[model samples]
Target: MDALVGFTGPPSETLLRSMIATLMHRGKAPGEVFLQSNHASLARLQLSDDHAVGLRLDRRGLIDGDVTLLVCGFLTRDGTESPGGSVALSGLIAEYRARGVAALARLQGAAIVAIADETAGALHVARIGAGVRTVFYGRYTDPSAATSRWLVASEPKAITSAPAFQAAIRPAAIAQYLAFSFVPGSGTMLQDVFELPAGHAVTLSADGSSNLTNLFPFEDGEWDGRGDGDDHSHWVAESRRVIADAVARRLPVGEPVGIFLSGGLDSSIVAAEVARQHNHRVLTYAIHFGKHYPNELQFARSVADRLGTEHHEVMVNPRQFAPRLRQMIWHLDDPIGDPITQPNFELARRVSQDVRYVFNGEGGDPLFGGPKNLPMMMQHWYGVPREPGFREKAYLASYRRAYEEWSRVLHPRIRDQIDPERDLESILAPFFQQTSVRSFLNKLMAINIRLKGAHLILPKVERMLAASGLTPLAPLFDEELIRLSFQMPPRMKLRSGDEKWVLKRAYEDDLPREVIERPKSGMRVPVHFWFRGEMRRLAKKTLASRHVREAELFDPDRIRQLLRYDIEEGAGRYGMRLWMLMTFELWRRVVVDRDRTGVSGGR
Candidate 1:
């Protein structure tokens, strides 16, 4: 992966060089630069990635006077690629003359840019969308240097590479990760560092002050009330147009692109659009569990055959799945406890041999709404949410594990550090209390959109794909498409019990009725079956490792129940919980213990 990391205070050539050296191991490229300015030291590493277009811009960081500007990730303005031709920070400043960060914030795509200017006496950073691409920053006091320094990096592992930086796993974040499978909101595993919110810009002044600017999130009390009564057919047409535009914008120019064909409505819609654009000669990839596995390779084959595309399939099993944990967890800098994560990794690894970029249809569920949300919404309509007892029960209904389950598994000292009820309430508060979100369905969608898609799914896929020497793009995550989703009324999102109603209607003509009507069983990995077989030994050994035992995160007896084949509870799903715990322990060993072989940082 290409690297971009810098600090606004103090000059340390060693620190910047250390970061650049780390990027070399991830991929091979010569887009490297090192400059030590009077006020700060900066380093930028832009590796060879064909899937993303803006690395050339990153490679050409502007060194105008006392300022150094470095950009990472891709950007587009009003659906048009930015810095159109031979443009740089100096060019932007000369043209716009107002720092240009405001214009950067206005750009709509997945991007993060950092500019450090001594003349301006402040460092500026901006992210394009909600956590699809973002910056993680922190301020720590370095008494040894007799100065306090604030820093930012693409990943937390980069910050840990600097001198005086020690990696410590935050217990509160651990509790959230254990309960939700992902730490929510701004929290990270590190103590003083937190991710800069998506669609925001941060300016850290040389005088030791920082300020933030909101770029993409909907304002509190925000409501368009525009699509409240639009005609159904018209809305469907509009939805199709919006989705198509989003996909087209993300397609890399002069780069070979492939589509992830899953035989589901969202993926089929994406594949059909690619086919229409390419005159039916497309490169498509799919993954299955072989004959004994419950997979939809047949349906995927049907879609590919109808489109007349060259389709390739990767058959994955327990043996391949269990062995890649160390590297897979390392790529996923943050622990995301999803069972499908492994398949996403293996698919990207297999696909990278031929393609530079692969597009997957991911945002349809959260944006257009999806099935399996009916049960969650039932509580919202039929039960009283404000009641203290009811709220806790409802929250747990959505969470993976409960305190009772943890009580048996966690050390008392570790268990006492967290309050699950309060933590979960804080994360869900934004949606529950927003007066503008009138529909129960929108509230549910909002929670999932913010946490599930942004924090959990996107990070895992993006990083893992990059780790495999390929770039991953989710066109469905475009800001324009996401904004259009909010414009549609809730009824169109989940009409009656038919979830993602508008999405199905939009592509009904292009895709088969059976594919559109099928229930959302989503890429099922045989996690349960694996746990019953080969994965059982791996899970047991990892959970009982010396580092994990010394950390005292779990009880030996509770670990025993998980290690044994038969186990189930209201506390957690046997396979899923074991996965979460196993992943967490592995993360602590790799990230917390600073094991160099396990994790690849901007060293």
Candidate 2:
């Protein structure tokens, strides 16, 4: 968590010291600076004194005036023995210049780097592929030109201040965030601030006067393994190999590594792999809401027993759920609409008390079609979507929703885009512009990867652990694993009614047939029922308050109606939409409002 800020203005020893001190808590080293203004200004904090490469580079920053880069790397609990030279900062410095953009092409670990040119004042900023590391930039307003200097940091809360930062929340992004509960791609919750897209970088000139130059581009459907005879079976084998490799790379140090085992196929498979490689059994953790939740204790226990891993199960009640909500929101740094965010936050906190690292299954769905929507997608693709009245049925469910709800949950624009009278096939045509089923599936995968896949997993789990100063790993998100998943044939990934078939096939030898055959039991938090039951009073008060009504972001009347009305017969998927909206309002109140007071600036 090291931060370096260099100003082109005349050097001020005292001011520089104060700026370095800003990063003191975030870093392990005492804050210090070396100024040769005409040369380059450098402030360095080596979060880990053991990792001395940062100290060496901090020295170079003072002498070299061509390019200035600030890098911060976080080692999860499991990363203690990451092979001596794997994370060397000097190698990264050399890679940037020698290998150019390719230097980070195969890089691992959670890290963010900002490279600045002292002479030319050019900056190249990026994060690791899965965005386990975060880098955000805001334009510092300057009057000399129509532009401002680009300020970048590791987190949004860090740079959302400085008088120069604009707090305009991107509207389109807000809609997507509501739908996905996480912002996708390079966009951030704030309008001016942007997360450097994963596996990508941007180059900006020193004077802060230049259009963004994308150093990495999103390339999909580019898997060429097919020509090499790596068909579906080959891909299944490769998937297993990559999963093992990724897990081995992130196993815990000192203590046993922890796993967020849900007893579902995803985490079960991950736990099995960890058990196979290491002597110590992986410690699997789960937060349960008694029997009302996923009822995963029995299953998770069974897997742990079979693999001889020690399992810790904590049953959670409402008392444990309340206090952690704020902490979770703080780490997520974004409006996370899901109720499970609370549980995941608590799970990380509990794990952080003892374990430094935990591995979970996050990206399994998007890459391998493990989500329920896949069946819908498959049904639509084969012509059932063309049947009359399907769209009508979906839409009527929304209208039939209880009047207690105020606004309809569906995005108004998405709803308008779909003709109310049209069939499901016609409704989906716009989202999937491609006619080919495989191509459309890929596009769907891309959306999930951008939003639901990484969005749900990283922000909730990774960010939660980060808030607690712990490290969490998602093996399903490994770049090679994702590429391999794409290489698998559709049938292997999703057959008849079974999703994640390829994932199961990949680990057939390791897991019991019944474990692999079990239904996908998502971590449950009865938020839908809670909206109509125990939390109804709170929902009414929150939705009717001046904060929500006066803010006018969402229609108050509509919200009230939705909250009051019970959609017991099942309001189609209306609950998901309504829940998303409610979470956004809560986020605005908690995060966006406090952001206005100026405490959440510059990490």
Candidate 3:
């Protein structure tokens, strides 16, 4: 969770310090700032002393005469000493020095790199690989100066710290967030602020002009050739080898590592691989919502027992963490309406005490087909009058978040500004329309990996774990595994009615039969019961508050109707909608309203 913040403008120590202050939670160590006549860059180092071997190389940046390089996450290469630190920085610098920005495409692992070239009068920022790491940039114009300044950081809050940067809410993004539970593309909830997508780069010039480029486009069908043969065993063997290698690359040296085991196929696969390779102890953590709600602990325990891992099961409920809601939202930076956000944060808090690194099975569903793809596939083949945008609409509805209720939930003023076609469907249009990816399933996988995996799943996990001072290692999300998924045929991903078929076949012997055979009932957070029980009062008070009404973003009457479960259809499903509303309001207080007092004691 170390961060980098910089701007293209006349050097001002105060401006740089202010931005760093907002991100102090990311790292308590004093920030190191590099300044020149027209640019300033700051790095907030957060790694503990035990992991500081590479601090000297790029903790601030690898500075050459006219060019300086800064990286916020680890980078890896074949036979590199480690995934990150001095060796990685040395390798990265060499590549950049030789190939310039093109070197970023050759880079692997999860990282965001920034190269500032004083001679070229340009600053380039790129997110490497599968977008496990995030970088946000926004343009801020100083009233006193003629030229606009571009502000960039690891999180959006840093950009908002500048006084001149306006943080107006983008209604269309909110609509998208409701549909996907997270904003889909580069656009965030803020108007001017944008997230750099995976395999994309942006360059900022002195004159305030910027150009965005897609560095590695997944839609290009480059990986299709890998799965060209009809021999299924070859793919299964190749998948097993590639996945093992991915996990091996991520295993920490001389230290215990933890896995967020849900007893699901993804986490189990990761755990089995880690246990197979690591010399150190393997710890697995699972969560349940007390005995009142259905739990996955049985399956998780079975896997843990099979692997002989030191398993720990924790129970999280609304009553225990409600007071920290605002603090959690603050950590999220962007609102993610998924109910599991709190549980992820809580689990990280526990895991942080035992290990600095944690691994999870995050990419399996998105990379290979998962259950969510089934409904869309069914609609694609069987039910539907063929119509334009049918795929987009069906995909949006599959999330089952707030998409159907977005318009009803938003105030008319907010709704008036949003056009679903321009804002919502447009994001998915390019992927669906791209003929380069021949299979419809692969196209869905493209959207899932690029949009959901990059934006929602990876960012949410990274932020929550980073809050607890832990780094997440997603072996499944490795760049190699991502390409492998695309290379393998669509049927290899989802065969007959089974999802992630190849993944299951790859680890069939390594994992328990029950774990592999069971349908993926994901870590289901009991939001419905919480709204009727523990979180009921809190939801009622927050949504009905004057501040929410004054903000003119949500319809108060609709919120009340949702709270009361007054709607005839989808009655019990209002918990997610309410959670999204509450998360946005709390986020508004911290980021938009700048209400520091409201952030503490989240009641």
Winning model by TM-score = 3
lDDT of each: 0.70, 0.57, 0.80
Instruction: Compute the lDDT for candidate 1.
Output: 0.70
TM-score computed on alpha carbons, candidate 1? 0.90
Prediction RMSDs, each to the true structure: 3.2, 6.3, 2.7
Clashes of 2: 22
Cand. 3 TM to true fold: 0.94
lDDT of 3 by residue, 450-546 (tens): 9998899988998888777677889888877777787777888889989999888889999989999999988888888888899999988877757
How good is model 2 by TM-score? 0.79
In candidate 2, position 86 carries an lDDT of 43
How many clashes show up per model?
Answer: 1, 22, 0
Model 1 Cα displacement at 520 (Å)? 0.8
Candidate 1 backbone overlaps, count: 1
**Tens-digit lDDT track of model 1 for 250-351:** 666665678888998888888887777643236889899879878998788888888777899998776886667777776677664776788888888888
Best by lDDT: 3
What TM-score do all the candidates reach, one by one? 0.90, 0.79, 0.94
